[model samples]
Structures are given as structure tokens and as C-alpha cells.
Target: MKTFCGILWEGVRKELQMSFSAFFRLLLGALKSFLNAETLQCQVFTSDEENGQLESRFISLVSNDDHKFTCNKKILSSKSDVFKTLFAGSENDQCVRFQEIEKNLIKIDDVDGETLREILRYVYFDVVDQNIMDPNPNLPFKCLLAAEKYMLDQKFKDSCQDFLVLSVDDENAFDYFRLAENLNAEQLKLSVGDYISQYLTHKRDVLP
Candidate 1:
């Protein structure tokens, strides 16, 4: 009787093991079938018009590598709220870095020099809006040179001073002075330095 009971228990255990294996195999097969059906359903249901619309929307929202003017205009116009999404309330170094990246998006086509300049001008205005002065002397110095050139071409003496004063060091300041002198903007040059100096003096006097 004991031998028979032991054999019966072994048989029941083997049956359960086989049943579990079969159950798992069936479950796996079902899952695979479901995934395959889903993929096929997606492919079969996508109409040509829907797919074309999707492609058009994607092209409009993202930068067009072939015609960069489209992308540039979109950025400048604040179209599709992409930039707003990216830089909502972001400032300082983060904003500066974003502006730099935006500058890189300007196209280098044969007749796009004005577009490039406009992008640079946008960057300049961004810096001004954030009251950012380059911590690195080199960057601000380069900016001063650019500002001087821009002012000479545009004849914007006041704007030139704004960039010149940002150069920070005496040498850069003198470089701005020379450029101003060459442009015959002596009065504007003197006024710009004096204004910045007075502002600095006031700021220092207020500091504890």
C-alpha cells in the first residue's frame, strides 16, 4: 500500500509539471499572436492621406535640412511653440547656450548673409535682454569688434557703445575707442565710457 501511495504522488506531480509547461507555452503563443495582429492592423489602417498629413506636420514642426530658411523663419516667428517649450522661464547660462545653438541653425546659403546677420543680431538682443556680459574676456572682445563693425556699417553710434563697454578690459575699451575715433564718433565714445563709469561707481558705492 505504501509503495502504491508513493507512486500515485509522483504521478500527480509529473502531471502538474506538464500542465504548467503547456500553460506557459500557450500564453507565450497568444502574446506573440496579439503583437503580430496589432502591427498588421496598424499597417493596414494607415490611409495615404493620413500618412501624408503626418509627414507634413512633422516637416513643419521640425527643422527642414534642405531649406533652412523655412526653419529660420519658424524660429524667428516663434512658430509652433517649439522654442517656448524649450526655454520657458530659462535664463542666464542656459539662455545664452540656447541662443548659441539657435545661431548655428542659420543657413549658409549663397545669398543668406543677411539672414546670418539677422540671427546674430537676434543673439545680441537676447544677450541684452538678459543683461548678460560674457565672463570670458575673449568672447566679449570678439563681440566688441563685431559691434564696432556693425555700427560702422549701420551708423548706430549708441548701439556701438553698448557693445564696446561690455569688453570689460582697458585694451578692449581702447580698441573700441580707436574704432570710434576712426568713425569720427569722439563725443559718442567719451559719453559711452563716462556713462558706464558712472554707473559702475554708483553700483560700487551701494555695495556693503
Candidate 2:
């Protein structure tokens, strides 16, 4: 002979216990999923880092003269946008392996061996030798062309422009002005124009 209130209390208690049990189970399942996802992500990252260390860190560059040069991939890519683009692979691609690097050699058909050597020297040591510069007056122009092609640092191009400006004279003023215009060198072009104007003024002043 249980009362109606007693029967109702029993039903409510049972329902509350069942609800709590279900909630705890759902929480546990979600936590397990989160932990498993974290572990998988960590494993993938570790694999990529280890594989990168084992791969080739250097790349080969071939000049027009058939001379091959080996450069550190990280160093070259950091300095030049062209190298960075060349080194970067597709989004779905994996890390570059040693065999793949060996098979792919970057070619610079417009630059010769000697010019390439100088470029490499500057890339490595950040210093251009005086002997090299003095002996070859045209080296700056050649380097400027290579710098433009490879998208080297602006400081290097400016240095080349400065050297060319110092070498400008009456005989080569027009030629240098044309080269400056072709290369989009504003400072060099203005300097050459000024020099040509002065030369013309001096000649007019001394006219017979």
C-alpha cells in the first residue's frame, strides 16, 4: 500500500541518476577525442621535423658556361625571392628529399661562370673584393643585371648604381643614361644628365 507521493519521488530519483550518468559518459567521450587528436597532431609535427633534418640542405646552380655551383638552400632562399620561389613546393608536397634535390639543378642561362662566382662570393661573405671590382669596370653592370634578374637586396643594386655613377664621364654619358633608363635607375640617370649638361655648358663658354 505505497502512497502516490512515494511512487512519484522514486520515479524522479531514478530519472535524475540516469541523466547524470549519461552526461558523465558524454563528457568522457569528448575528452578522449580531444586527447587523441592532440597526440596525432604532435606525431605529425615530429615526423616532419625529423624528415627535414635528414633531407638535403644544399642546392645546385648551373651557369651558362656550364660551371656548377653548390649553395646552401636556406641562405640563398633567405636572400633572393627567386630562390625562395624555386625552393617552395606545392602545398600538398612533402619535404624535399636528397635525391630530388640532386636531380633538380637551377639554371641561370643569362649569367656566366665568372659573374656567378662573384655573386656567390657576395652571397657568402657580404664583401666584394677590390681587385675584382678594379680590374673589371663592367662587373658592376653585370652584377646589376644579375641582381635584377634574381631580385637580390636593394642595397646591392644601389651599390652597383653608385659605382656606375662614379665611372660616368663625357664619353659614356649618353650610353650610361640609356643603361640607367633601361634599368630604371633614377639616380644614375639624373647624374648622367647633369654631367652631360655641364659638359655642354663648358664647351659653349669656351666657344671660338
CA RMSD of each candidate after superposition: 17.1, 16.1
Q: What tens-digit string does per-residue lDDT give for candidate 1 at 76-169? A: 3342232433335445342232322242342222223332333344432332322323343333334334444332233333444455555535
Candidate 2 residues 180-202, lDDT tens each?
A: 89988887888888999999999
Count of clashes in candidate 2: 0
> How far in Å is the alpha carbon of 53 misplaced in model 1?
16
With a 3 Å backbone cut-off (N, CA, C), the pairs that clash in candidate 2 are: none
lDDT of 1 at 129: 22
Model 2 whole-model lDDT (C-alpha atoms): 0.74
